[model samples]
Target: MTTVPAVSPAPSAAPAAGSPAEAAAPRRRRFPAWLAVVPLLAFTALSFGVPALAMLNGAFTAKDPSGGASHYTTANMTASLGGAYLTALTGSVKLSAVSAVIAAVLGLLLGQAVVTSRHQTLREAVLTASGVLANFGGVPLAFAFVATLGNAGVLTTHLHLADHGWSLYSFWGLVITYLYFLIPLMVLTVVPALDGLRAQWREAAQNNGATTFQYWRHVALPVLTPSLLGGFVLLFGSAFAAYATAAAMVGSSVPLVTLQIADAISGNVLIGQENVALALSLDMVLVAGLVMAVYLPLQRRSARWLD
Candidate 1:
């Protein structure tokens, strides 16, 4: 009954120094393809990131006599939140809201029309025109509107719509002008969403005995809502931040946040107005950021279904 002791196993051999395993150097970690974007990242940081940080810094700090940041304070925010500045901000928000709503409705209609159209050429033309017109801003669009609608101008003298009920330099008029760009921008923004709407959904709805109206009301509208709302918010930010055409056509007649910013930077003889301008800019940035905060989530939600 005595069993032989089990033989001990030999120890594993160490690899030879020049063996294939040793010769194979650890695969060098190749740089990621995204590293090629480093220059672009650096450029963006220098452009938007640095300037925004400086603006944030200046917004909280008083200007020194030596033209640099001083001690931090809330005076800038207070001043910005009060008086004509407050009025300007309120007016800008109203304008942006009104225009954005109008643009969203009109752009949605136009975008849907283009998307549902039978003619490919018409869709291409519509999109091309929208793309161009969305960017048609600053001095040129202002000048174009002025030439057609200014005092003693063509339409002003010929049609006499002013004699009826139209002035392109007033608040409502500014809304109309803002619509020129806003509507097209909305078109561009919403068009993709419209196009992404799957035909299968419509077919499924029909197969389930759903009418066109029911299909749209239940399925399409819900799907489109995020994209629509996101675009509206984006349009709001655009209108809120616009300085050029307002300055050119309406000038101080509007008293918009953007125009106020310009006046603070250039028109004021008082000390520290520059800081005030920066503060105003800060206010605008905050509002725009808020709008974007809303837009980003909606955009993400939309992408989930669309993509």
Candidate 2:
């Protein structure tokens, strides 16, 4: 002890900020993150981007009727904007608007109820059901509805709904059918917004002597408006793009743009309308783009308030 003091070990040095070790560490970490999204990006490119590009190319290019080379032209685009095509477009828009409005209102009410309920199981049940029902459409759904509400359906036969002029092949009937899935979609979209509502806001409103209606009308509605509009836009796009159910249920009787596109592609209505189908698809893309433009802003606004 008297001879010498014990020597202390030196601390280990960290890699320098600009060192290869430090640089390589981040690269190693980032590689996995980037790799994780590669499959998703590839899938999107293959499924959506490629198809979209092909559609755009086909929309503006027309094959010669006299067995000549294909050439770029605007005739298809012009044709899509008028005549029967225009009628189909207008009909689809009207149908989408009507269904979306009705579904938005009803779904908002239902979501509010689910959010306010005290029962956890009931809330889960409703949400689970909504998730399933929201994705339930196309031919199976069409068949289900037809079996339940068609002219010779169980309900029509038992309840005399057909005799009362309740036809499932009509516009109003399609509206009703759309509501089946649209309302559930709205519920899924709005429930998270409802859940974002802070209890303090309600408490503060009550402390300020605000009634339920007053609180909702003045405070809650303003905050929730963006989300409501966003949900409505989603529902509208869903209804507008829907094809299988409309195709299987009412066929050309509905005069939907989607149905028209199918006719153009299959040449059922006219030969050499394939390019026109692409043009109609382009029109739909433009409409969807406009809708998304509106929806994105509303979504951002809602996020600011809710998040």
Q: Would you estimate the TM-scores of all the predictions? A: 0.83, 0.86
Clashing residue pairs, backbone N/CA/C < 3 A, model 1: none
Q: What residue runs in model 2 are displaced by over 4 Å at the alpha carbon?
A: 1-46, 297-307
As a whole number from 0 to 100, the lDDT of residue 42 in candidate 1 is 99
Residue 68 of model 1, lDDT score:
74
RMSD of each: 8.9, 4.2
lDDT of 2 by residue, 1-307 (tens): 4778789998989998898888788453345567889999999999999999999999999988789689999999999999999999999999999999999999999999999999999999999999999999999999999999999999999999977889999899899999999999999999998998899999999999999999999889878988898888889999999999999999988889999999999999899899999999999989888888877877787666655
TM-score, cand. 2: 0.86
Per-residue lDDT over 193-252 for candidate 1, one digit per residue giving the tens place of the 0 to 100 score: 898789999999999999989998988988998888888888998898888988889888
Can you give the lDDT of residue 275 in candidate 2?
92
Evaluated at residue 293, the lDDT of candidate 1 is 83
Off by over 4 Å in 1: 1-27, 31-40, 63-69, 296-307
Q: How far is candidate 1 from the true structure (C-alpha RMSD, Å)?
A: 8.9
